[model samples]
Target chain A: MSRLNEAEIRRIAELAVKQLEGQATAANVEKVVHEAVQRMSGEGAATAARHERMKNVPPHNQAKGQRIILTAFGANSIGILAGLTSELAALKCDIVDLSQKIMQDFFTIMILVDAGNSDVAYEQIRERMARVGESFNLKVIVQHEDIFKTMHRV
Target chain B: MRIELPEILETIRMTEVEHFDIRTVTMGINLKDCISDSLPRLKNNIYEKLMRTAAEHVATAEKVEAQYGISIANKRISVTPVALVGDGYYAEDFVEIAEVLDKAADNLGVDYLGGFSALVQKGFSKGDLSLIRAIPEALTSTRHVCASVNVATTKAGINMDAVYLMGKIIKQTAEKSADNDGIGCAKLVVFANAPEDNPFIAGAFHGVSEPDVVVNVGISGPGVILRAVKEARNADFPTLADHIRRMAFKITRAGEFVGRKVAELQNIPYGIVDISLAPTPMPGDSIADILKAMGLQDVGAPGTTAALALLNDAVKRGGLMASSHVGGMSGAFIPVSEDQGMISAARAGHITLEKMEAMTSVCSVGIDMVAVPGDTSAESIAGLIADECAIGVSNSKTTAVRVIPVPGKTVGEEADYGGLLGIAPIMPLSKIDNSHFIHRGGRIPAPVKGINN
Candidate 1:
């Protein structure tokens, strides 16, 4: 793009100050004019340029969580509108398949994990699950894939 | 140690163990060939079949449980509807055969033997006729044998004659077993759409299509589900729904795991998982406890129906989301003798048979563990079973009755079956009788105009 010369920048600054004259007092207009010149000449707004450049970065840097299947009581308790996949993303857990049903209560969730950088422990996962149950008034349980399918009929 | 309160500690003990258990190991042996003209030969064949089936069943079931470190609450068997097998055999001969079965179960170390049943949904076969006729004597004569009659089922309307006969037979059966806590009646169940693969008794039957043998899992957890629901009640509706869904998923998963393992160890095909909230006669093991925790004084309180409906819906919803194959009566149970809260409610005059029947509309089975007065006619028992079956047929759902008539035990007297068949204090029934109509001996026609197709 063609750059504005010093003379043009000066005229632009003058016009900007003239338009703001009725809305501001003399000292305010002079302060505004001084700030306008810095922006127009690219002396400020470096972060805005950097943001625009980073907008074109690769997709790998913006990946999200995965989804899996959870099985439990009465009937399919998975919500139709959201589906488990979306909920898994919301909760940052990867889900796989519906596994088993137990004594008219308790659901088993099966998930695939990267476990790359999670700070949470397996016990913590169970505690968070207990909290989930308390919050939703449900009995949510998690099991590894082997244990789930081992007890399940094909 | 800061010890917990006594009652609470007792509740925990009951949840863990208190001699309440898998009451019987019933091996359902098919008796198709035990129909000889000579009563002696028929009896011998029946004994041989039951002995063969029960022995292997006990050994295999015990071995499987030991191998997997999982509990097989009851190691029982069910056979084809008895009437089908005893075709052309005299009713007297059938009684001899039933006696043989009792002996076989005793000899085989099995507690109870089920499948002395007849399926007369559409029309009674000649054998069905004889078996139904001999029910009272057959049950009364045996110590370990159990019998059930399917008089009505979906697609088949009620049979008034069978209904009436069942009532009379139940009375007779009660009279015969009077000294034994009317134990004969304890072994009977009137069913509609009975599953052929249920692992539980006194109504389980092995269907025709089943492999010569197969394994079914009956996992129970009134306590587990109640614990989950009680923990979640403080949350909002949506949150509570999610919590129930998650917990149900886990419990069912556990059952599914154990069921498959049992099936594999038995070397049989795995049957569908039945997520019925089977309650125990133990304190914390009651579904009514869960309801009370949900804020009810007793099971039949005003909001009880709503609570049951919510529980049924929530349970099914959660179970379906978790398992692919769901079958049998997959709802909560309310059997009086089988559940402590129910027994207490009946004893305290807080619950009645009518209310229990009403609740069956939302339960896994209808009118289970109900004990009536010994003097009551078989017609009334038939009427009770019929009414319960009618609800199931009309709704196209599974319903059943395991009504016990404790012979010498009065309305307030107790009948103890030891172990899972806990002590049962009788409940009062309406005096309105139906002997005449039930005795009419013809069929109650299938719903004519109700069919849309």
Candidate 2:
């Protein structure tokens, strides 16, 4: 679902209250507000609840494991993604996000994967990626997403 | 908290490409309870206690490293000062205990075992004198044992007698290990106002006030800090300082996490996290490089000390905000031999011994890992220690001297102390003799500024 901005939420709440006017009992107002929010959020309330539950459970036990950010840097070469993704797939890591670019003979790739459901441990997955990168003379680094959030964000 | 994609990539680059890692996880063990008048029983008790306390140290540190995907470089052990524990023992007896400590460290797969120390900041007890006398032999005979002596404090004046004694002892140690280019002296340190829970080698010792067992972690990442500074080249001073402070906070937070995890695994209390920007001999991991990246053409050039002052203060400010129990010498370490940039600067004659001493006044520890000529008088060495002690006592900061006098090596030569100790060029010393001043030694009275009461 797309993000709901503060302005949109406020506008929807105001509209709901205005529509109920004199008949706006507390329960009637609450129902109108909930329905407006659900419609504006582009998902049913039940689907939002399911998403919250998914977040509460440990990432490894979920269908998609914890998020890992893998970065590779080296000379521009073909078939790099083919090599890396095959190894990751064997380890049960699901690709959640990926970006690759080549500039002036330099190649760089960044992949965010969910390794929570992977049978391999974090260390093992890192080692496996390192081996694959080394075969193509590239440098691969894997780190947990939490480290970045803790360091970069408040 | 949701982690952004760019932040994750930045962390990966820092750890994998920039060589960011925890420097050490040192376990401090109190051996006061291991004291015994009988030499053999005392040795046995000390060994058994070390074995029991530090048995899981290496394995646990390794496990944690694998779990976190970060490297924990060294696992070491520090115990209560031997002078206090080996009371009434002869100098030779202290040597035996040093051997036992070395054996225990070997058994536990630890790289260094500190606390063969004497605290004679005021005056020498019989035990302190004995341990001082045994230092040269203790350091040369054992491979992993580290020795330190505290000779001055703000409350108590400098002990001139101990200073003189350490000078002679240092010379003896260098002579005893001449074949190794005075490597024994690399393992010894002389401190003024030394911290009790320092996790760095050559000065680490469990203070008399510390608990039975505690885990202290030393986190280091000169490369990481350098990268941050380089990225903010065009920014103003406040912005640059904020960048460094933020980086330091993250580094210290990681250190605290590792320290707490290791402490929990060992079932011991978590001790302080020493957020010293310790540098190795690696190409990109020098503290001097950080200063150079800050726009100094060379490390010892003008404004170098000012840059170091800013870096050191910013690190402490950042680290203090990151960890509740920050202690030890929590600033950037400027050991010459152990830093590649420093080695290059010294070799190019851009930096000098006096400049290093001046830098230490602002940095964490005093002149460290410096190599002087063999013919340099013992009196001069004592005078150097006295000068450094004066700085620590006056400023109420922790200062230490770990200069190695490479016997038969003169200026323009190099002494290769392999591995983490690195290599040093034999820097020239003053030709002026301070023998009369050193020989007429008496306590330099504590400064009036120390009387804040």
Candidate 3:
């Protein structure tokens, strides 16, 4: 959440204008500026650093960036994962980590999703996931993982 | 996952099953600058200030609730004590101010607005006297306005005159709202050593020293701790305390997260989190139930005070570590009507007024939500408040009285407030005359502890 300095912002704007000189339409200028800002804001760098720091951790536990934990539980049935994953994919969300367990007649699945890349709002994704759960006759809930980190971690 | 399955499931159980939720998100808006000699200009200033600052308070709270999957029970506002903002006004003018606050609260979509208050712990200002006289009328006329008067503190001792005046005020308020079982009294609190940044209603106020605007939160989770204590049934005292502390720590973290998110969204400064284990009328969500889980046969049993002392201490110790900015009444609240176990014990003749008084010495608040017969003399109510003030001043703790003298109700009947105010069975009080003592009202000198500095 660090803010860029004035000098840094001017540098990014200058680079964007110089790169888009030949094809400087409004849309193209906007696209280049957006990408440049995203790259300079540490979204790309922070993700790389986070992955480097989490190299020793298991893939299932290395949830970083803007991620959410989606939990689904109900009677054991087919296609729950398929239905949920398809909806997440259509929404442009990445399934960073997932685990499932079945006990007797009931199944519970927890999925760690990297939602940073999604163009859809988190609220809409939650609504879509809920619809997916309703279609599969399961109870699904999505919550930002920060709550767990705050409670369980130091 | 970095957070194991057990951790995730435990959180879900606490929120979905055990009723762990942020009890309130209160925005404290300082209204000192709105003061004026002209009442209309004053009213306009107060309304515009509150509406402009807190326009999105409820919506921001709801958005955070949705984001975290933990529901916030109440969205409220606490302004500077009205008496301070409208100092030169008379009683009727203060009542008009209350109406404006109520309108602002309704328009903002908040459930309650506090700080219809006066601080008279040492002595009354002209405004304080006026507001005290206006309480019964102001509370009866408004739906969302809550009032409090601080009559005592450790430093200044008990203002016996203010305490006696409050007793009469409580009676008048009861008479005014008699048809609703003296429900107006439920919205009024008399305090000793009241906190300035308290987010809980009926006693919350934006203290004079506070910033222009800030946000405070109250955390409530009796059910979560009750479950933890129940699971550790056979464990000894230290282990029991440990279990309570861990549960308190987790809930405090959640509470702070919610508070900070709401403040962040509104772009306001975040204040303290009052980590009080405030219970609702829900059956399992009772502090008395937690005591029973800690091996008490029932509330008001012989060791009840000891159990409560331990529970309150552990909650404070645990919560203090979880949040750096812990303030307000951060202990186990044992309000009778709002907690079902407390109501049950009172109805069974197990928990009495005397025992509750003793418990408040070791807890956060005092004499909260207890109902009495309509005929209880003002002197008797004053005596009860004086006793609580004595405990608070002597022990250096925050204490309060929210006693309801339910009009036309007797010991065998109950007064129903219906919502979070809950219901209260009429508890018997001593019939002995205390008029001679109460009428000698001037001041009880500050206790020895008050001179510690």
Candidate 4:
């Protein structure tokens, strides 16, 4: 999972507010976005190869926006195709890859992030993110970067 | 390979959860009568018995496993009680017998060997006393050979004498093979009213009623069960029960298939299938994770009993439905020392022996993976063993204890059994001795007096 900067989290909040408006269920959209953004911390995968690759990329690279598609199901239905670029806007977090899948009752969001360490309080953020999921009636679980790597390696 | 989720569910209909696997195929043989005053003759007799019975055990196990597509996780052997066999023997004689047992297991392709045991809860027999004395040497001198000494029971109090001996023996065994990674102690176990027909090794023994050459199995699948649980954590309690019941059914079916096949391959009659959920050192420790998933921070919480009861009951139901014959300690293992997760919880002070015993009430086995102070008296040890056995006998289920007493360690210290059985921090036991009660030797009559089951 990629780490996002405060500005990137703020930008995500602004976009989510703009795109969803009422579609965003929570009264505090920024809190939800920040929480979601914080989840994109260190990329924990099966191997350290990606971390090595992320290290080589210029920290100043700003134009490289990545796309992420997130879907929320279960509690709600939602689909988001997000466009993000150079991690500088994301506090050195480069969105290398992202995917989302939802069935009738379960929602999963997978992301690959190349950013600074994103470890932060997740519970309060999780509450904010819950509103985004509530609007769609989806139970969304965002997995970090390297988790999918080791998860699939098994 | 991806099909519509609903379509897949509809197509399969998830029919009655036919997920079956083999638990274990234990070859139990009587070795007590094999003991002789003459050391060489005793060794020879043991070799003849085990070699003759278990010669084809491995090949047969493989053939059966392949034929059934069910994983037979453990291939093991249990013998007559060591005390019964080594009656009136010296320490050297006991060591000699242990070596023969070890050689027999190795040659037979058995991964784990059991039945280095002494049942002296009520009182020590002539042989029981000798066997108890010989345990430290027997365990230290041999590999793959396991040991157990019962010191107490409900009917009788505790055997402080035996308890003291055991404390010293555990230390000696650990120190003697400290270089072999102290792997010798892992092979041994202690118990109260130890079952003779247990298919699980390091404790299995051939009961007097057992057929001369039958094969039993101890099926283990905590990993498989854990996966099922993780998949259904969000479901409600009843739904979870349904999921668990289905999972258990599949596991038992697999066990029965493997056990039958192994018996066929070995040309012996297929015995019972023990559908026990045994944990390994893997990430998904069935016992620990199951507890965690049940909403407890760890396994020692108050909810532990209810959760364990459900697990044990579901396993038995599923196993009984799958196989006509089911025996052994077929329940969840609470071996604190053996499970890495348990070690973590214990280290964090989230678990205790009392809570462990509480969970044992619901689960099949009793207080496992416990390490005690080296100075604990034999009588006190006997008392503890008796209390555990009383629970088993009164409840009409099997219960046993396998405690390790690390010499020179006080409560809150660590004794590293290492590799598989794992390490145990010395657990505190009440310093009070119950030797006065243990000194009174009288058999607690079997619960079999009832007319109907």
How would you order the candidates by TM-score, starting with the best? 3, 2, 1, 4
Cα lDDT tens digits for candidate 1, B129-245: 889778879987886677887777666687767777677777777777777777777788778767676556677776766655555555576666677677787776566566655
The list of candidate 3 runs beyond 4 A from truth reads A1-65
Per-model CA lDDT versus the true structure: 0.65, 0.89, 0.92, 0.63
lDDT of 1: 0.65
Docking quality (DockQ) for each candidate: 0.04, 0.23, 0.47, 0.01
Error of 4 at B410 (Å): 4.7
Score candidate 4 by TM-score against the native: 0.65
lDDT of 3 by residue, B1-453 (tens): 377887888988998899999999999999998988788899999999989999999999998888778889999999999888888789999999999999999999999999999999999899999999999999999999999999999999999999999999999999999999999999999999999999998999999989999999999999999998988879999999999999999999999999999999889999999988999999889999999988888999999999999999989888998999999888789999999999999999999999999999999889999999999999999999999999999989899999999999989999988989998999999999989999997999999889996
DockQ of 1: 0.04
Q: Which stretches of candidate 4 lie over 4 Å from their true place?
A: A1-154, B1-23, B32-38, B67-69, B86-88, B150-185, B373-380, B409-413, B432-453
Fraction of true contacts retained by every candidate, in order, equals 0.10, 0.37, 0.59, 0.00
Which regions in candidate 2 have their CA more than 4 angstroms from the true location?
A: A1-145
DockQ of 2: 0.23
How big a share of the true inter-chain contacts is recovered in candidate 4? Answer: 0.00
Candidate whose DockQ is highest: 3
Predicted chain B of candidate 4, TM-score versus the true chain B: 0.84
Residue B278 shift from truth in candidate 2, angstroms: 1.1
Give the docking tier of candidate 3: acceptable
